[model samples]
Target: MSETIALSFEEIPYDWRVPGTYVEVRPSYTNLGVLGFPARALLIGQQLAAGTATPATPYRITRLDQAKRLFGAGSVAAAMAEAFLAANTTSDLTMIGLADPGDGVAASGSLTLSGTPGASGVLALYIAGRRVPVTVAAGAALNDIAAAIRAAIAADPDLPVTASGTLATVTLTAKHAGAVGNQIDVRLNRLPGEATPPGLAVAITPLSGGAGAPDVGAALAAIAAEWYTDIAVAWTDSANLLALTSELAARYAAMGRLDAHAYAGLAGSFGQLAAAGAALNSPHLTLIGARASPSPPWAWAAALCGVATFHLANDPARQLRSLALPGIAAPAQADRFTPTEQDLLLRDGISTFDVARDGAVRLSRVITTYQTSPLAVEDTAWLDVMVPKTLSRIRYDWSGYVSLTYARHKLADDGSPAAEHAEAVVTPRQMHGAWAARCKLYERQGWIEDAERTVAESVFQRSASDRNRLEARQKVRVIGNLMVLAAMLQFEA
Candidate 1:
């Protein structure tokens, strides 16, 4: 005696309640990723604007790597130079030499030291981290400036040389060597005993009173504002990208099983949006849809007999009730049926439907005819309809009707296809075989728990911790799988 017997309705007594499907407790999970792109962008942008980081250049990453490596060896000069060149190609700054007391001497009286270097700007003289005072003398050589510095040093031993240009007068650490109203005059000169030095006068003048502090506060404030603005813009752009990713994820969640034509539209739209998003540096997105497989065993069995029900297409009545409540809800369908030029068809005894777009086929109607007994399970169906027409006639189906009208279908060779025409379509027959095989295997292998575990684990992995950067992604995938399972249920019965 087998655990269960397989019999048709005819073999079993009508009074006895046969094995039928009923709804079971079901649960689902979703996942998504939500990266804060704007925040990252703002951080990087602020760093660049604040001068904490240099402007990025072509190969900037490579140069930064090289600079890091060279820093440990005390040979970063070359690497720094390379990074500088890589960052900037026009303006440049160079280091000359250290400023220390030596090389020259200074006197109190209006002694002048002059050895002009270049016409870049006013000559700068830093001595012991302080400025030395000097005035330029017209038409003086660098050597003459050096000679004057020597003489000043000889006159006053208290004055000591701090720094000197390669071709200009030597600078002293202090402008005043205990002399009241002391002044310095620098004439362009060269090094002592040199044949000839540059004639440019590099002069330094030390005033009597204390120097005034430069007011750079206003300038610094402006710079700070600029840095903040740059960061904000970067952040805004990044935020938009994150927002778009979220929107895409939501869109995919709403997707469902498509008729052949609807599938075509969806596939096309997805491809276009995905490409555009990639170009905008947008994160990749996923969409969920019904697959060719049914839901879990119990769920599938319940759905096959129309017992288990998932969320339905938005119903106007439900929407009205929700609006009366406190929180927002999904969109609802219109109260009245909106008709278009296209015809709708509902397959007999199946939940699947189709929308036909062709000539002279404007509407469809479902006409169910009762038989003496219900059809047997696992049996193929056959039907033939003859219609007298002046021209070729076409047949199409939709959610609630089957359309028969005068329309010609393009054929490559002979009139009708060889019974196995592989036209694009979404019918129960096309989806059931695959579902049944998988369901039987699943039952035999007892893999229902595995499937549930996989889904649950995936959801956890996406929402792992508080940073579910991929929450949207998970949602789309979940929705797509649900759609597939829903479609499978219609035929898996």
Candidate 2:
């Protein structure tokens, strides 16, 4: 009189005797293998008053134009979106835009022209490492040259700066109001065989005076209950990074189980980056250093994480070395880190990037800023970005299988006599077998090593304290990345 195959009854009533060949549909998803990870990324940045999107609101973005509309052209969000889309266009992306701080002041700089040129030549000006050329005519007035510089800068709406010409000086003002603007560098003649026009002298005054970063807390809080695997943060300030580090740690806790990693880029010298990296110790945060690249560091951060997201989704255990970050500019050779410096940086916990032969920005090996454990002891458990990625996928796969297979199942002792076709009667022994099978799947996928030993040593039993609870202590050794190989060559004499 009872159906043991599946107790998930709905349409078929127990008292219905006249019905012939009546069937109920109960879908089972437990048979599926390790499912695909739902990779999602979030871009957090400030929006300009000219933008239509409301501050602190999150919106899904598939195209780059949408971010420009929401955060304004040349906005921090727009740069991040542009870079991310270049690296991975198909990943699910959400934007959380915040208004500028009430007391924020935009950074400003100047390029003053002096001396008269007897011969006309093109004057190359670099802002944020991007070239803005100003053509000069023979015997042109300095004031006119400054005006031309302003025109060139204004024509490009995506330069992250606005320009105004006063007499012989062209003033550049950051588009956003924040201390982040101060890092937008100003320089000239970055390319080989490039030089100033004859008799023309241009004085470069770097951007400064930007102050008051917005409360990124509001933007971060907006991600509540959402799983953003990778966050492209616009601000790299210590306070903001600390908030993200804490938030990610909390999310990765057992109670939360919604782990996230945040990426940010900083433009500074080797010493500066070393000092900055030394101060941070977080497994969930990654900071990249940009030496002389024209693009902002935030853009680099988005591009780096965006590129990694695609690879990590395909294979969580895969190494991300040498992955090309499309649309991200690599620093010039002179500004690039030497091999020794790179090694130092990697040890210092700052992610490093190198330039390819084709002038593309490529990751050497991305790493988190986690050097020491909670007890301040030296640790490398969470050093590489791949560790958390693999662990997250493992947890995801196990949780998926358990949630689907054991839904509403009656728990019992290991030797309990289950009814015929007892699909709803689950025993500890059955759970052990299920775990072993899952571990085999993990091993086949190359995510773990020694699947048999992992299951054999693991424990699964009914809880002694809680009559209805089943406790499982699982242990799986994650495979390591073959980052180096060394062999000795012996002479056969």
Candidate 3:
């Protein structure tokens, strides 16, 4: 016996492991990996300087000045501001704006003033929300006044126009390239002459340009590469909305990455919104229409998008009701929908807002475009009944959490062939457990319901024929918000 000494050796497991390895299971999903973490919004519109912005690139706009610089101080910038203000009302927001090189013509207008000033006076001129006041000497000629006005307008750095004209007429060229320039109004007040103030006349010449066909495609391409929860096309025209819906649906189906919901508004009556929604018939799109009166369609869309983004970024599970729109005014009572009008809107998949007693505008019911489906049989159809913003956030959170969690873990494929197959199957089961746990967390937080049953019905399987492949299915029960109540009062003696 050669010593017959039994030597003990430390047994080390070949499997990779760290002494304190820990996986953090988030209670909720978040878009932290995106360029702009919480308040990211994509705004598409016609930019004054479309050439300066790169096509199909998500540009982060943190300040109004940055938006002005990228888009030029024009209608596009104004739309961006509307969106930014609406989003920032609840929380700080960052807008990613894409300037659409639209086909519509830029509008040009000229104001011609007749007659000379009889006495020294002050005249105020309003153009595109910018006001300029001119002081005329007692004996100043009409042409001289026009020249002074043009010079003054040109001197102001804030006006989005280049002024040019002769003595009696002033020509204002829009800095932005779109039909939005057509909205510019020029008002003259505090004139020098007593006899009708020599009447100021205006002539508007429309700009002819490219059809915005390329714009939606470009925006969708850019959005496909990034992460965003809310998208608003600043234009409210039917053609733009149609193109946007088509592009968004196609891109989302193809990539199936993040869920990007589009917010839009119709400037027509309740019937119009209903018709549009029925024609579109898409769950991914949310159409808002004012029943109280005709409202600024773009502003409504922007405000809704801002609200949706804020809620999703902060807490993806909350509803967007009773949230006050800071800059939005309440629609007129005449414009508000009657009970019958509300029924039509709900049936047609349109969402409307309500004006609170305090004059604050609040979201009534955010609906989706899945209106015609049989509500009794299709659970998905019922999804349209809840707030669209809330539903979108839930879907995004669950999908993102599942994707990120699976991507982080590596499967073991280096054992005996039987062992490898077993390990592969085990990995998915482990993943399924983690995913189920996440769903449970949402249930605990009132974001979802019936987590256990949903997980059991969900599929998690590795292909028996292919050891490397794994497939999974996840079902979720989204918890709805309390939007309505019914009670019967009993009189006691």
Candidate 1, residues 1-493, lDDT tens digits: the string is 6333322232346465767753344221112111111100011111111122222211122333343332211111222223233323232122111111133232322224444543322223322112232333545455655665544444532222223333343434333222111222222221123222234533345423312211222222223222110011111122333453343223223241110000000011223323322233211111111111111111111111111011111110011111110110111122112233111111111112122222111112211111113333321111100010000010011111111110221112222232135232222232232223332333232322233333333321223454312232111011111111234445554
Task: At residue 69, give the lDDT of candidate 1.
Answer: 33
Please identify which of the two predictions, 1 or 2, would achieve the higher TM-score against the true structure. Answer: 2
CA RMSD per model (angstroms): 33.3, 2.3, 8.2
Per-candidate Cα lDDT values, in order, are 0.22, 0.85, 0.60
lDDT (0-100) at residue 397 of candidate 2?
A: 87
Using lDDT as the measure, the top candidate is 2
List of clashing residue pairs for candidate 2: 128-294, 129-294
Order the numbered candidates by lDDT, best leading. Answer: 2, 3, 1
| lDDT for residue 308 in candidate 2, whole number 0-100 | 76
**Over 4 Å off in model 3, which ranges?**
1-39, 50-57, 89-103, 106-214, 291-295, 373-431, 490-493
Q: Over the stretch 196-311, how does candidate 3's per-residue lDDT look in tens digits?
A: 23333333343223133234666666556666667766665567667776765664562665556777766556667677766756666788876423224555777787777776
lDDT of 2 at 315: 86
Best-to-worst TM-score order: 2, 3, 1
